[model samples]
Each structure stands twice: as C-alpha cells, then as structure tokens.
Target: MKKAKAADGKPFQGVQKLSVSLDFYGEKIDVGTLAWSKDERRAYFEYHPDFAEKRLNVSPFKLPVSEGAKAAPNSPFAGLHGMLNDSLPDGWGRLLLDRYLQKLGYDFRLLTPLDRLAYVGQVGMGALRYVPDNSLSKTDDAAIDLDWFAAQAEAVQGEVDEADVDRLLEIQGGSAGVRPKIMIGLNRKTGKFVADDGTDLPEGFDAWLVKFKSNVDPSEIGKEEYAYSLMAKAAGVDMPATKLIETKKGSYFAVQRFDRTESGSAHVQTVSGLLEADHRAPSIDYDTLLKVTRLLTRDERHVRQMFVRMVFNVLAHNRDDHAKNHAFLMAKDGVWHPTPAYDLTLSEGPGGEHNLAVDGEGKNPTKKHILKVAENASIPRAEAEQVFEQVQRAVDRWAEYAKEAGLSERRLQEIDRLLNKRGPTTAPDVDISPSP
Candidate 1:
C-alpha cells in the first residue's frame, strides 16, 4: 500500500500500481499498468509516455487513454462510463459498498480503492472491465417501483440502517458524486418508474435517473435542469435528451442513462472539478480546452462542434459552463468523441465571469475574440460563421423553447431579457441593456 496527501494535505492510502486487463467487447486488451498516487488522489497512466494521457483522481485503476472516436465506447472506463459517476449514488453507493463487504464477512472500512474497483465487476459502464471478480452474478433486471426505491434510498442516505436495503445499496457505491439518484424505468402502462434490479419492467417505461433534492438546489431544481436541457438542445448544443419525471411530490428532472439500455452498455468518462484538468480552478480557457479536445479526439469536425457550443454558451448566457461539464466518449473500437453537453444553467460564475475564458477574454468576449478562437482552433471561417448563425437563430427562439419547457411567462421574459442584451463588451463589464 502507498500513502500520500492531497493538495490540501489530506491523507489517503492506496495501492501504487496494479496490472489490469480490460475485456473490451469480446477481446482482451491490456490497459497496461496503473499507479495511484500516494494520496490516491490521482491515477497516472503510461500507454507509452509519448502517447499516454494521465487521468487524475478519476478511478482507483488508471485506464489508458486512446484517440479512436468509437473505440471502447462500452469499456467500464469509457466515455459513457463517466455519466455513471453521476448516475451511481455516491452516499447511497458508499453505504451499499460497506454493507456488501460486511455481508461477505470482509473488513468493509479496511478495503482499499483496488477492492472498490474489483466490486464493479463486469457490470460497470463503458467497455472497460477490471480483473478477477467473485464470479459474475445475474444482475437484477426487474422493474421495481421508483417511489419505493426513492423512499428506500432516501432512508438509507439519511440513516443507513434500513431493512431489506442491502442489495440496492451495494449497487450504489460503484459510482461517485453526492447526488442521491437511483436507476429506474418507467412503466408505459402505469406511468410509474421502476428500479432496474434484474427483472422485467412492466410495458412502456424505459431507463432514467430519478434525482432527489440536493444541498445546493431546490426540489424543482430537476425541473429547471430539464428546462435547461431543452433550451440547450434548441440552442444547437449537442445534448442527450431529457424529460421531467412527474412524481406525486413534484416533477423530477431525469436524464437518460447514456451507459445502458435493455440490451447492453456504452462507454463513459467522468470530467469533473475534482480532477480531469482540475475543473474547480478557473484558469483553463476555451482555447486550451479546444486544443486538448483536438489532441484527444484529433477530429477537426468534433473540435468545430465543440467551438460552436462554446460560442452558444457565451451568447446564450449559460455561464455554468465549466470544465467538468465537458466530456469525451469512447466506443468499443476505442474511438473517442465528445459526449453530449450537460450540467448547463444560467449562473453568474465566480465573480460573474466565465470559469473558462474565451480566447483569453472572459468578461466581455466580442465576436472578434470568438473568431480568433475559430481560426486558432483550425475551424474554417465559413464553417464557424455558419455554426454561429445557427446558434444565434436558435437562441433567438429561446421564448419558444422556454414555453415548451413549461417556464412561466415571467421566467421566459427574464431569460429573454438577458439573452437579447449586448454580450460581454469588455473584459469585466457585462452589458445588460435591453436590445434594440
């Protein structure tokens, strides 16, 4: 075991390196060796240092990086797998992880990160699979009631000691983050969401993430997220489809799980503030982000697509756009591409400026700055202009989209008021005057 400290001097102990074999699709591919830093805060990977990428504090097992857009899309550590980071219940999953180990008569707290990696088995997201399981068990595919499971998860999250909560809780720890959500399916006939526990779901409903309230947002926060998803889509951003799950209490925001379907899995990757270029830090610019996207994806089209979204985010006043909100997805063949945009919202960033500056200009990025980024990022002028025009046209219809999202007339007018104003005119000044 290796021991190290986080940047804040917090102590963490973990294995330094372990040989890992990935069952990518049907073939066996070696992800090479992985080493956890002394603090277990970062995972350093070497797939030939010349071409390797280091994914930090992501997972206990450091998976190798690849450049193929479709390659290993379903590998446990693949692109879609990152969404699992959000889908899998963090607090709930932790309780389950501990209880599962306890049930197995193992030291739950003594288990290392490697042990946690092993718990994911073959059922993990993406296409990457870790080694040596306790043998695979058929996962529960039954459609359990969502209200019931939400009640159960809420109980466990609040008090950990709930009856008949063992199996569900174990499934929770396999992912990270602090959200209390459970994977469920809606019954087409009954209009109820059921947890996927290895059984048949009643006809009509499909997979979803039923989220609960968090410390930072209100209960209707999910509704706002749903509205944001619709607005983002209407604004020409590539986004996974979203819907509002109407519970007895209120409408809950639900996003389709990119990692799973009735048949199989998709690759995922987690790009967040805790790691993956340190999203919490407000130093990364869209230029650097674009460059990284080009380096990792190597697809000029994807780069151009990303650039278009950046411009849309800026002009549309979706300021919650930060580093972690962007992700790259991988396919079974090891191909890599940008995942759909998510976690978008209208927010006044740290001090009301974008966390990621636009071509070194954050507060008042002009059209010139955006064009400069297009040129530097190898985006052709004609293509950049076309994308900009498309986004502008969609944004112009924000009222239409907002109404579609069921926003009140007052709310729609408020957002419209912000969108129509002149965008950042200077580095520090945001022009909020009503547009002509």
Candidate 2:
C-alpha cells in the first residue's frame, strides 16, 4: 500500500509571500503581507489598509503599529520572521517536523518557515490561517487512547519502530514546548477524545492540548502540573480549563485551547513575538511585560493578573516563566488581552535563576522583588501587596496540594523543600513601597 503523503505537500525553497488572513467571527479578514525578498534577508510583514484601520497590533514592537512594510532583524528569529516563527514548534514540534519530512522523502534542509506553517496550516493556535493548506487528515472518528498514544510517542522518541510516524505527526501538529504533546478534540463532559480530522472538530468537542512525559521528566510530571493548575486557580491566577487525563501508563496534563471555540478563534502573539525578544534566555523583564500588558490590554486588571502570576512563579518555584510562555490573545472584537497562565510547574530555570527577572533580581526573587516589578509597571504598591498575600496563601498550602495531586511523598517533599526555601511562612503586610 502507498504510504499516506505528508500533510505538507512540498517544501518551500525561497517563497516570497504567503497569504495571511484573520478568521474574524467566521469571516476571513485580509491582513496584509507575509513576505521575503532578495533585498531583505529576514522575512518581513506589513498590515493591510483594512487591518490597520482596526488598530489591532499583531506585533507592537518589531512590526509597526502604523500601516507600512517592516522587516524584522534576523538576529533572534533565525531566517524566519518573529511572528511567523512563533507559529513554528520549538523543541518537540521540530522533532516531529524532521520525522515527518523524512517519512515523506523530502529534504529537511529545504524546509522553510512557510513550509512549516503550511503543515501547521489552520491547525496552529490562534487565528492566523495559511493558504495552500496541506495539513489535511481524514479521520473517521478513530478511537483515541491516551495510554496508547503515550507509548507510541515514547517509542518514536526511543529506539523503536517507524510505523506510527504519520499518526504522531498528524496529532502533534504545532505543539510547542519541551515535552511532547498533541492537539486533540476533547469532550470534557463525556470524557471522550475525537481524533481531529485536521480541519474542524466534531460537534460537542473542544480543542485540547495533551502533554506527555519527556525523557528528562519524572513520572509524576503530569500530576504535578495538574496540581499547579489547581493551585493557580486557587491563588486567583486566571488559567484556562485544565484536566488530568489518567491512563494506565500515567496521568497527563491537558488544558483547553483558550484561543479556540466553535464559532471563531483568537489571534495569539507571544511576548517573544511582540517584543522580538529571544526566548532562549533572559532577554526581557517582567516589569516590561506588565507595562506591555497595560499598553496592549489597556486594563489595569490585566496588569494585575500578570502581577499575580509573577508572584505565583516566585512562591511556587515556577522559575521557567519565560517570555514565550506568556502571551496576549486578540479577541474577535479586536481587543487584546493577557492569555491565561499555562506551562506552570516546577522549574529550576537557567542557572537556577528565574527566566524573567523580578525587578531585575532573578537569582532570588522574594515578595520584595515582586513588589518592585509592580512599582516599575506603575501598579500601586498596595495592590501588588494584596496579590502577593493571595498567591502566598495558595502556595502555603503546597503540602495539601501535593496530597490532592496524589504525588509520592518523595516527590512531594522534593518540591516541598524547594517551595519552602523560595516562599516564606507568611508574606508580611508591610507597606513595601517601590524603590526610587
């Protein structure tokens, strides 16, 4: 039997322009250019006359807020544009791309950012949809067993078989992060998984992203993440709907696609995309992130929400709060808002420091540092104190959360010690004014 063709039909050697659009309330809005040329080494983009009229900045920093052509400096974004690069998968997704390319007998070296976006097609997070779509998978509501998929993904990662390569790539499209994950159609009420046909979800199912254990992770990672989600919600941090899918192998953490619904999708631009900051290191600060939140969302509440996350990251020991992990979502109303917190778990960060500095202090970011960031963002110090107390209360219950997540005592204590050192017994209700 002939092997199924790779979803990406062909490689793009040096494509100039890619048609870009926004799926606004089920209608396509022609949003200007996604192009490259000989004169420009890095890919460039510009807003169409109509999109600029709406005043929705796709990227506020590198790309102009006004209507005109702009080329991104090719330092951080490789050869691809930063915004478009955000659409490409980083760690696991890149691995899947290589595997898929080899399976299709295509030269992986010829792979361009646009080509990767073609495979991402309409399946990528948020509203940007690519033309010449090639990521089409015909599925007849195939049974989806998380346990089976987990094993298959493991096999592909290990010294295993090549038979399940296509299935893996199809399900794992455009999933970012270090851990291997897949985008699936999930019916939360019914506890059913609908194999995504790569175009639309079957009725009654919402888009969900399910994660598996990477080689470096412990067995309880999913449980730990689920525990963090619960803690975040209790801490008054806005997070998307999350569930822990337990299988025979182990539990997996899954979060609802906040950017997707039945009628329309939200446009997403990561902080890295917005600022063209290299996500690989500590290129940006949380102070600037909060200010950006205020600038884009124009709401003190969103900035406050971000402040709450910064506190949680510190107290809960979630030091891997990198730029790419934070994002802003554009509603169909053309308003931008801070996305719900995800990717929250135990992380040592780079050099055991926070990925984003809290008031320029990364190695040891206490409540004092958290308040400093708020002051830098011009948030009233009192509100930051309230946020600090609230997140501290939630984090103070780490032992209870560990039990709730059913983590082993050894694993629980490991995290418990880390949090204890990071978080104090109680956050003082002192008037810690912002530093001058």
For every candidate in turn, the CA RMSD to the true structure comes to 8.9, 6.3
Model 1 over residues 174-210: C-alpha lDDT tens digits? Answer: 4443455666666545766656542334567665555
Per-prediction TM-score? 0.67, 0.89
lDDT of each: 0.57, 0.77
Clash number for candidate 1: 54
Per-residue lDDT value at 105 in model 2: 63
lDDT, candidate 2, 155-266, per-residue tens: 7778475547677777775778878888888987899886664567778898889999877776788888888899999999999999888777779999998878778777
Task: Compute the lDDT of residue 409 as modeled in candidate 1.
Answer: 64
Best by lDDT: 2
